[model samples]
Target chain A: MSLDAATKPHEQLAEYLATDMEAVNRMIRARMASEHAPRIPEVTAHLVEAGGKRLRPMLTLAAARLCGYDGPYHVHLASTVEFIHTATLLHDDVVDESDQRRGRPTANLLWDNTSSVLVGDYLFARSFQLMVETGSLRVLDILANAAATIAEGEVLQLTAARNLETTEEIYLKVVRGKTAALFSAATEVGGVIAGADEAVVKALFDYGDALGISFQIVDDLLDYAGTEATGKDIGDDFREGKLTLPVIRAVAAADPSEREFWTRTFGKGRIAEGDLETALALFAKYDTLEATRRDAVLWADRAKAALDAVPEHDLRQMLADLADYVVARLR
Target chain B: MSLDAATKPHEQLAEYLATDMEAVNRMIRARMASEHAPRIPEVTAHLVEAGGKRLRPMLTLAAARLCGYDGPYHVHLASTVEFIHTATLLHDDVVDESDQRRGRPTANLLWDNTSSVLVGDYLFARSFQLMVETGSLRVLDILANAAATIAEGEVLQLTAARNLETTEEIYLKVVRGKTAALFSAATEVGGVIAGADEAVVKALFDYGDALGISFQIVDDLLDYAGTEATGKDIGDDFREGKLTLPVIRAVAAADPSEREFWTRTFGKGRIAEGDLETALALFAKYDTLEATRRDAVLWADRAKAALDAVPEHDLRQMLADLADYVVARLR
Candidate 1:
């Protein structure tokens, strides 16, 4: 996990996307400023300056490069994808009533819920403007679909917050809607507007979809393993009654005692102390965490297969590395 | 102000819009519903079904018709305008932390702030999708610009909240961004997409802009003078310390002691229970309310003049009447 190695995949991604995403970051910080709204700079900067991997925007840039795009609009497209991602995160924090994001206080917790809502809106509007500047109706189409999917996912998460009957299929759909759809959209549109042929564009889209699926599955896997390194507390999902992939599998495979335990914990939505240990024990008993890790690797393999349709290039290899990087956490 | 023979103009305009806006209303309610996100249907229905005049959509519908549009896309365009408006209101009530809207419990108070933000996002995303379906880049430009203006206005309002030194010009900018830009965009895009000449489209835009200015000024006016007619409390704006058109003008025109009272009340965000009366008396003493009313009428007159570029038609006449209806509250 250390950054000392020069040949590390994350480092390779950093070196690959660094030059362009630096520009993307600069644009984000510049556009986020407001003459009238001083709080805008503070709240947006808190999240923007936070150490995210920039994987989504990097996917966009990589996709466009793979499609042989030589246009400068890809930078804006990259920045736009990031804005959509950032805006969703801000609103997600508000909707989830989350205080900690990346181990720092959330915008809503630091400011008020009103600032979070309005600032999220400002970012959304800014994304729209950035997309329009690209002058690519196809890209707009793709991103607009992603935005709807993201909103739908957030709403679905709200309704399913305390519900225990949320199925594996439903969970997958929600995860796709919330995370993978945007990942795919960010990549697919880049290939699309670059005039890539139908095969390559669709391949990029599928690759992004699978990469995102793997990315999120690994995240859910980490949530169960107690070794979750994503800064968020491992037990938050259980505490909040969120049934991710591991929990869904565990519930499906539960014994009588396990069923009653889940009913008392997730269904009732109030877990006493050490319920985390009990849930972790159940996960171990059902081998759900290991199974979830295998699922992540399966998605990563499918994602790599998706890229077989495209010609090999440095950027393309980097994308393949990213797919591998998604499942690297499972190790 | 009574809905009698003397107010035939308002009645005529209402019937005119009611008849023409049928398609717009149908599309809006249908499109607002989502199969996956039931919260959208729930929260949207709370506000969409809340009885209110559909003036903004009417402006859009009339603009397209008066410019001799023969296409069906205007129906979608009008719905786009309303969707954006409703979406903002959903968010605005949450930001304002209001308890009631249109005599019913606000969505935030009823459901939660989370639902308000998510549902507002749902509608906004839905609105963008609907506009994208229209396939007119010009229309997208118009609506997207309006979205930016609306967000800017919201941010400005947030920054200006409880600050009393905000000038009349700043108030106008906030109101223009918050209200007028969408109103103007709704109409302008209609004419633009209808293949109206630039001059005619500009006229429609001007008419809508003036009408919106008049509409908002009259709304501020009603905060002081309206009874059961406007349905909202008469002095909520005063109580909220919103430095609207009347208050901004009055503050500029106040004497030294009155200025000190105004500064202490608004600048410090502190007020006694009867401070509303004191503010009202100050507004009266400076004739700020009456001056603002006159400004609304002047804009109404400008609205009528802008439509002169379009040829005489029943829809054009109704649009002019609608402009008058927006200013009818001043009487």
Candidate 2:
């Protein structure tokens, strides 16, 4: 439980919130069981038990604890956040036709799409039930809005995929919808449940929002940079014709032949061998990856700055480090 | 609008609650819209406005009105109910790989499975938002549990599909989860939002549960009986190897040779061209379809009897008739 600097910031946060994290895991296991449908737990267990960082739930716990609140409902809120995250991953794999997730076969691959869809739904309902147990109307409202934003961002991403017309503004909106919305909600609900003041809650929300944006941008950059840590094949997003920030920027600066290259590969979904190399080459040519990297760093800085309003605590320092760690992955 | 016996009871209820129903429709249209993701409304509108009977939402409206509680939030509740239904239908079509819904091309078919899945999630989130606006934690709890049941039933059905050993009890569980859960929740939440007594809420729950069971049973019967009124091709469920009530009973009464037939067609999913006719012949031989019809009638009767606990109102009488009318399709 020592604060080892060599270890990841998330690992440090996990150590700091070790007791609450255990409670959250226990609640997740207890609630995921079904009286009649064994398949519900089977699909759920595959993803939930997979060695995820458990980063989102820890945000909830850290936010609540940092606000000087000592309550049992923080565990419930953390479990609720994790359930929502797991449910989305199950559905995302199905929508993306992904074969692998968290370095293991996806639920859709291990089980059928039907099980994944239905089981994801079961988890969503479970999450709703958990939040309702808190009896906080404000928490329900925040999480409900977060759910809508996440779904809307996903749909927007689907429609915006491979379109050369996608702008950076749209990319930010998509990022907020798909990633930041939940992050912000996860942190905001924790503060709300702890009865934190408006200023402190707003600070928590800002921190989460900036951190999530940085996290996603770094993820998008790594898709081209080829990182083994993410367990994603390099340029998988390119193969899928997803218009992430780097590609959107590269397309923005493309010349005639480059535009056609972008159109043939991304817009028309006619990716061929070495398309990844060509995409990377274009990124290098336009320095779009660097620009994207700068964007991630800027967001990370903002996340750290947001914590200045919060009371000084060990968790607060680790959270600021967490934002840095997210962008530091690009190094 | 007159409660003409010649007219269907749902239609009568629709006419009786026209004003409220219109408001529900307007709210559905408004809430389904997305400024960023036009695809959300497109996929949603295809199914939402495709001339559905709006039976689920109408049940909510009728139940609230019958409870003698006048409130603006009932419109919101009815819309919430429909959004949940539409969202499930979108995902169900994707899970079933269905081409047609409400006798038109499914959204999954027109768009891709991705659109269907994401748009369905959007609708579910939208439904959650609508319910939160009602600010009734009791209603949220009822709907949350119902959501869990619906999802659990679907998972149970997915696991039990094509299994010859799936008993009547298991079949009932599947039916309750996939169909009756929503139906009961619709009525129960209506009574709950009206602040009705526990007895009245329980009665509403009972009425909805029985009506949904009978409705599903009759629908299964028509899959064998081939009624154009239901907008489903006879033997569709058989072709899909679904273990509906008729198939479950037929298998229970099946002899050795009949069991082998059931095993090959259903269990192994080796359905051939003549299998539908053979299955129908077996159903006739054992009078299993007749038995299923009797079960449907019994459930319809139970639904009508449950109405006796409620006050004598016109909506109550119409609800009773609605129960009978569900089974009337079989005749």
Candidate 3:
């Protein structure tokens, strides 16, 4: 890990983009409201007010500034990205039957699944409105496709859950759809709005995509390693019977007995007491955790490599550092 | 009524727009598919292939044709509108926890709630993508707002479901959001896409808005009238404790004894045998069912009146007849 990343590059980027962040937040508050349906705003406020790192929208602001955009629409684009992210989170909570998010009761838990689903739909519709206001068909195209890809990725993950046949290729596709698609679109739209050259836009997209891939891989690895600040329960992926990267790798390398263990736990949903510890031990013995960490670092390196085409600037440097920081927790 | 109007105007409209309806159907099939998530196509096909009338998309097609649109993009607009409607129905079934739709098992029943929610989201995203391909920001804006309104109306309905105090004004608002908003937007976008005159566009919007309101009111009334062809079960709203127009009217005029009955059935949810029949008796005493039917006729009249400014085309005549046919069953 880089020495400077120890100081938290994400917070640094947030600080640097505070003004634009405020604008995005204002736009979010303004657009999430429905004059007739007070429940829409109430449910949305419950989630949007919960403090998660506004990383995706920050990526958009930073990318736009780095691309020399001085226009007013980047804020709209950033808010649009955040709205899409928030909508997905609302639906995810309902799908996961989750009760807590960002250390607070989830919208689905505070309200019912009906409110969560309907409000999520409202936010998605609002997000499309915000993006359309940008008046860039190219921007709309990129964001719309990203929205579809995110849903596709989630559905794929749904079918892949607890299925031992899920491959690394399929995992990558899911990751690209669920996480990186929005990340890449956030950055790509930023550059596209700035009228940046195609190469620069492509570079920003690749950097965001690789960085997002790295971020998700690190998150998956941390779920097994017991990180307190991961905002996720340790071994959650295990308990949920999700066949994430480390577990998938461990299953691939398992002997017949170990394969039977995985089948009982994930495939058959027979998770018992101490089974998580046993699974952790298998992850250790197979070095699958380390393998997953190595994959994260590789993706982080690719993220940095993608930035080589962009003009060397402080924002670009911060973006590169942000990629490093995503994996820095492993250190 | 016109002599030919004794037949279903919806079928006549479908026959008139058969070629365009085929195009819309092709787009629906093509766009509902996902290469990675086969489950999406599976669920969507169950609904799309069902023999329900393609009414909303037909509105878009008929409006565009009546406005002298000869372009190919109206088909895209029509397809987009249908996708939005289908997506909402999928989510609505999950929200309502219904076991059947269009005389078949609901998607939620056959697949699950999670698939229905996520697949509904996919269709919404797909609808946005389809609209954006037309390269019309006006269309995007209209459709996006309509989508938001649909969600808003649904949330409003959720909060107002069992409350006896739900006024006629609020019921109308819910109806506007849930039904009329999309209908108006579908027709509005068709005219906007064809570069129709402002008066013609406004006329089309008003026509669709009134027609949708009329359509929903009829559906609500038919639930009490014992119509087998309503495709909705008799007393289903009463069973679910939904306060539709008839109930709202009865509640408004309820004497103390009638109010107590409503409180027992709807407010407290302590429905017993013969409760629905008793509710029907109250509806008859207050004349709320007949009053609701009158409201439907009023809206239908307004719908036909709004078409006065539209060009005198065969499709326009069919649309006017369609409004009449919406209330024809009440006779």
Q: DockQ of candidates 1 onward, in order?
A: 0.57, 0.65, 0.65
- Interface RMSD score of each model: 2.5, 2.4, 2.5
lDDT of 2 at A246: 89
Q: Over the stretch A1-331, how does candidate 1's per-residue lDDT look in tens digits?
A: 3323567665676687788778888888888887766888888888888878787888888888888888888888888888888888888777666322334467777887777777788888788778887777778888888888888887887787667788877887788888999999988988986899899999999998998888888877777664635655677778777778888888899889888889889888767889989988888888988888898899999999999998778877777877887788666
| Model 1: docking quality category | medium
lDDT string, candidate 2, A193-252, tens digits: 999999999999999999999999998888888568766778778877889988998898
Ranking by lDDT: 3, 2, 1
Off by over 4 Å in 2: A1-4, A98-104, B1-4, B98-104
- Write out the backbone clash pairs for model 2: none
Candidate 3: CAPRI quality band? medium
Model 3 chain B weakest lDDT span, ten residues long = B96-105
lDDT (CA) per prediction? 0.80, 0.89, 0.89
* Superposed model 3: Cα runs more than 4 Å off: A1-7, A98-104, A229-231, B2-7, B98-104
Candidate 1 lDDT over B102-178, as tens digits, reads 43477887888778888888888888888778777677777887887788787787678668779877888888888
True contacts kept of each: 0.57, 0.81, 0.81
Model 1 residue B267 CA deviation (Å) reads 1.5
TM-score of each: 0.95, 0.96, 0.96
- How does residue A88 of candidate 2 score in lDDT? 93
